[model samples]
Target: MTGLVAAQGRPVGTMGRMASTAPLPLTVGFDLDMTLIDSRSGIAATYRALSAGTGVPIDDALVVTRIGPPLETELAHWFPAEEVPAAADRYRALYPSHAIAPSTALAGARESVAAVRALGGRAIVVTAKHEPSAELHLAHLGIEPDTVIGRLWAEAKGEALREHAAQVYVGDHVGDVRGARAAGAVSVAVTTGPCDAQELREAGADVVLADLTGFPAWLRAFEAARAA
Candidate 1:
């Protein structure tokens, strides 16, 4: 049996809004970084560029390790409280030129989104990164989700997910679990990012996947059950 269960522990009908009357289109939320885009190298390069331009000492390797949180959160570690705002702005400005080219789409990223559409569902990307920068990355990599929401993270990400009526939220962080929980959506976590499987489970993820490669199978099983 596939372990794709709903929030209340039901194996079938993962969506809280599913109706036995008729099958309706579904919306699935995904995290941008780590889950959809392997932006670690690009992000690191951007940080390095920011450091060079700002004359600040930033550890690109170290920053890339904890990649799920917001940019300002990490900037705080390297910049003074007063300088964080400016540094964040500068980083965002440098990101396009320094980060976009090197960033690559994670394996199965395109197929995962297409899988949603193949089932008459909408795939959306929710992220903490700035909206413009997020759009640039997606444009650069040719990864097109139906909707892309930016500047949201962790529990705060629930705002956009709820608005889109997303029944599932896929991501690579414990914060993402909280976001899905906040929106009453099933949390499907991928192990491609900093968080490990155990950590994701401990954080209350409903499903733990090795990477996006397994998403289509999971989505297939999920829809099959919903239509059952």
Candidate 2:
């Protein structure tokens, strides 16, 4: 039920190299999973469970690499399309209990969200994971985003940005770079996922961060530019 679905839309722009000018009021979009919460331990456990259940002998590194997209998209790469539904069902059934028990929020994530909110901006979470699962993870992290979109691909997330009127997107995957560009929003990439800063830059991200641990300074810079 999730992938990059093309809808008639405007393309978003990246906050890439902007002219020295005033910044505009903006809504910020964020990615869940690795960007906000460190799901590595849980995701690794999930892969282990999947391997044990299917006897497919999955590799944790390979599986973890697929964490940024929809479960069905990842499943399609390793299994038949017909098996995707059941695999997703099984994964969902197992994850809450067996897989994600060790999940935790990333450092400075909560502070970043609050900082954005304090600045009269809104933060919405856009994720490729299932919606409910995304929400649970957010709750687990003690965050209350203005909105949470799940199971979306780049183009789908672009559409979501249009719906939310978002002006910038902060994420940690190359696909997020594509989505922000496609949506005509400023794209900011974080190096919290499998993708590296160089990878995100190559994907045409507007901004690249080591992590959200230092977002307040960046946000302040953006605000200053906006007020200029």
Best by TM-score: 1
Write the residue-wise lDDT of candidate 2 on 124-154 in tens digits: 9988887887888788768889899888887
Model 1 ranges with Cα > 4 A deviation:
1-24
lDDT of each: 0.91, 0.82
Question: RMSD to native for every prediction?
Answer: 8.6, 11.2
Q: Give the C-alpha miss distance for residue 1 in model 1, angstroms.
A: 49
Report the C-alpha lDDT of model 1 over 120-185, residue by residue, as the tens digit.
999999999898988899999888888889989888999999999998999999999999999999
Sum up the clashes in candidate 1.
0
Off by over 4 Å in 2: 1-25
In Å, residue 153's CA in model 1 sits off its true spot by: 1.1
